[model samples]
Target: MALTSHLETLKKKHRDMSEAIDVAQRAPGIDGLRLADMKKQKLRLKEEINRLSN
Candidate 1:
């Protein structure tokens, strides 16, 4: 279904954001504000995924 595909895409984005967060944390010069924003987006995606799943 369309929802299934969308869910998959969101999950991928969420995972990518998680990895990005990790990489950013390890690096020295990354912007803290930007990283926080990404974390917020990732959390939003996770909420959306959960909403669609149930």
Candidate 2:
């Protein structure tokens, strides 16, 4: 049950990060490094979710 809850939270965070990246891309003068970092974090979350799922 706890693992399921953790997975849900990670999924929510991944979704939010994707939205944030989209908004940041639209905004002016977004930091390139920060955006890259956010994408990396999102990828890590996805990997973890996949690992836990199996």
The prediction achieving the highest lDDT against the true structure is 2
lDDT of 2 by residue, 1-54 (tens): 999999999999999999999999998999999999999999999999999999
Colliding residue pairs in candidate 2? none
Instruction: State in Å the error of residue 19, model 2.
Output: 0.6
Candidate 1 ranges beyond 4 A from true positions: none
All candidates: CA RMSD in angstroms?
0.8, 0.5
Query: Pick by TM-score: which candidate is best?
Result: 2
How far out, in Å, is residue 31 in model 1? 1.5
Q: What value of lDDT does candidate 2 attain over all alpha carbons?
A: 0.96
Worst 10 residues of 2 by lDDT: 18-27
What are the per-residue Cα lDDT tens digits for candidate 1 across 1-54?
Answer: 998899999999999999999999999999989989988998999999999999
Q: Mind sharing the TM-score for model 2? A: 0.95
